[model samples]
Target: MGAASLVALLRYSDWHSWLGYMQQPYLWRVVRFSLWQALLSSGISLLIAIPVASCLIHRSFYGRAALLQLFSVSMVVPTIVAILGLVVVYGRSGWLYQLFDIHIPLYGLVGILLAHVFFNMPLAVRLLLQGYDLIPSGQWRQASQLGFSRWTAFRWIEWHYLKKVLPGAFVLIFMLCFSSFAVVLSLGGGPKFSTLEVAIYQALRFDFDLNKASFLALLQVSICTLFAVVVYRIAPVNRQDVSLLAVKRYSLKDSFWAKSADALALLVAFILVIPPFLAIFDPVFSPIFLLTLQSAALWKAVLVSLQIAFPAALVSLLLGVSFCVLARFCMARRYLALLPNKIEHLGNLILMVPGLVIATGLFLFLRDLGWGFQSSYWIVVWVNAVMALPFVLRALMPVMYQQERRFRAVYLSLGVRSWSRWCLEWPLIRLSVAQALGYALLLSLGDMGVIALFGSQGLVSLPLYLFQLIGAYRLEEGACVAVVLILLCLLLFYGSTRFIGGRSLVKH
Candidate 1:
């Protein structure tokens, strides 16, 4: 798909025209804004995440475990839903605004930064916490025995693990922010604040400037590809560590300043989490919220969303499995010495391709092929599957490699067929498989970019429906849909994790 899109761009666009378009001041502004905001968002998220993760590591507060789990909710929450929730807290008529009689615009760069931090900061915290959890307990004992100060412990011990973990986390968050579309669309206010992804959408969808859109899409792809290469070079390879039985930590010396800082960090984390839940739950008891439940359009959208999500998730899982299997097989047979690296590069490339770019490419390709918007349902499924591919691979590859390492010789010696080999391995990797499926499902459920582009009046998914409701100034209905969407995604994720196998191996 990526190659086809690039070919289409090159076939139609002249080099001189593309270079001229690239030289425009407005184009530079878009590029500048995109890169600048992404850098700031990633940096700010990591800065906040370190202290929050550290506090969580050292403190045993009530709801700490639940709070950690809540961090995962950001992953599944639709961007529009999250933006709406943020508006409810920070917009002109929001709770904060009403209480303080202050207007904090939930649009432009401010909104973008706020939205990015809300989504990515929790992810950073989770990754950092995982890193902290992997630290050997004896290391903490050693630091304590040496009478290390808080600063000494953090600098000598905590920073050591974080140095390895933070770069990857930063890169992941930066890429996510770079690819942001729904948030930029809903909150950017105008083109002045637009990112490259949003600019691509505008060029194609609104201006009908296919040539310009193609050039911009190619530029976006090239920039993302460069970032992916850099990330692959810099990020440390992940190794599966046996779960730590217990994480030991030296008790902090009692101090007022320390307690206040921890309290403040927890408060900020809670602030990040509260608005989304509030946006969902607080509207449930409203009179119009129940009325939305009876709307036929709501039910239709739910059915359409389910139809798209399930197949997309399955397709993504299949593609990820096929990639892992092919890579493993090639490596085993020495068929292609660079197959593993190529496969890894492909996965990273997919991770960097924004959904908007994929949707734009498919839309153009299908239009050229005479498959009109009538085939949008299938197009949506295909794009969602592709977008979900990276997550599926990330979740499954490590386990697959581990299984192959441990079982390949045994299976070969016994002359095990492919089917029997899979059966033997299924029990061991089922949990990871379930995770991959759930990740894909949740991603498809929350996706807005592709559907926003491809959805017709006759075929509206829940995200599209919710977006329409918000656009039509039906906040009550939008809120109701947002709540239902959140519940549906969470239910699907939990069900996939719990019942996909008789015994679930997911620990956290």
Candidate 2:
């Protein structure tokens, strides 16, 4: 589908037209802003995550476990939902502004930065915390026995893991922020602050400029692909390792300043994460909650959201499993030695390609091939499945590889073929499969990228409906929708994890 879209784009757009669009100063501004905001967001997220992760690592406070779970929730919260939460805290009529008579401009670059940090910081913290958690208990004991200073401990022990993981985390966050569409569209205030993703939307939906949209899509692919290549070179492929069972810790100074810093870090993290939880209450108390329940459109949107999410997630899981199986088989056979690496590269490439770019490419390709607008439902499903591929692969590949290595010899010796092999592996891999499906479902449920382009009155998913409610100045109804959407996401995520052996799958 991606290849077909690119082919159509090249076929439909002329080199001269692409050159003309590229030469425009505003186009360059869009590129510049995309890179600038992504850089800042990634940098800020990492900077703040380090201390917060350290605090989480060292301190054993009440509610610490619940706080970590909240971080997990933050990682999967929908982008639009998170943006609404930010507005409740920082908008013109928001609590902070109205109470303090202070304005922080929730509709421009500042808002963009704040939103990106809110969404990505938890992810960074979680990733970095995992890196911290993986340190050998013996190493921690040695460091403590040696009375290593904080800086010395960091330099010798902590820095090694951070240095290995941080680049990948930064690249992941940067790609997310760079390709962002819904967040920028809702909060950017106008085109003066637009990114390339928004520009493609404007060109296709409003301007009806296919040439311009195709050119911008090509540009987006080029930049993102470059970043993907760099990440491939720098970030090591993640592997699951058997580790010592004992919990380990490196004692901190416990001095006044150190305690104060840890307290401050926790405080900052609380402030950053609390608004979304609080925002859920707004619609519950508001009269709009009843109205939203009574409204048929709300139910229709919910049904539509489920319709898209289930199929997309199922397809994503199947593809992820197939890829893992194929890669494992190729590795075992030693046939096509580069095939597994290429497949890995393909997953990275898909990660870099924004949903908007794929939507644009597919839209152009479909239209050129005489598929009408009605094909958008399928398009949304296909693009969303592809978008979910990387996550599914990430969650399943490690487990699949581990299972293959552990069982291959046994299966061969026992002659466990076909149905027998399936029976043997099902118990081990079911949780990973469920995890991938759940993650994919959450992603599809919250997506606003391709849906923003293809959605119509006839086909309204929950995110699209929520966006509509916001656009139509129905703030109360929008709040209600936001609450419902968030709850549904949490319910799906929690249910899937629970059904798939609960915390075991979640940890994986």
Tell how far residue 443 is off in model 2, in angstroms: 1.5
Question: In angstroms, how far off is 321's CA in candidate 2?
Answer: 2.6
lDDT per residue as tens, model 1, 232-327: 688665443443434557774445666787899889878877765686667888888788889999999999989999999999999999998987
Q: Whole-model lDDT, candidate 2? A: 0.80
lDDT by residue (tens digit), candidate 2, 1-508: 5666666666767778667776799999999999999999999989989988887877788888778767767766778888888998988888888888889988999999998888889878977875775577888889888887666777898888777778767877888889888889989999788999889888878887877877888888899888767876877654433443235576855567667878998888888888757866577988668878898999999999999998999898888888987887776676575577567557746756667667777877778789989889999999999988877875676567666666777887988776677778777777767767877998899999888888998779999999888889998889889999988988987787678634563321
Model 1: number of backbone collisions: 0
Best by lDDT: 2
| TM-scores for all predictions | 0.88, 0.89
Residue 164 of model 1: what lDDT?
A: 73
Give the C-alpha miss distance for residue 263 in model 1, angstroms.
3.5
lDDT of each: 0.79, 0.80
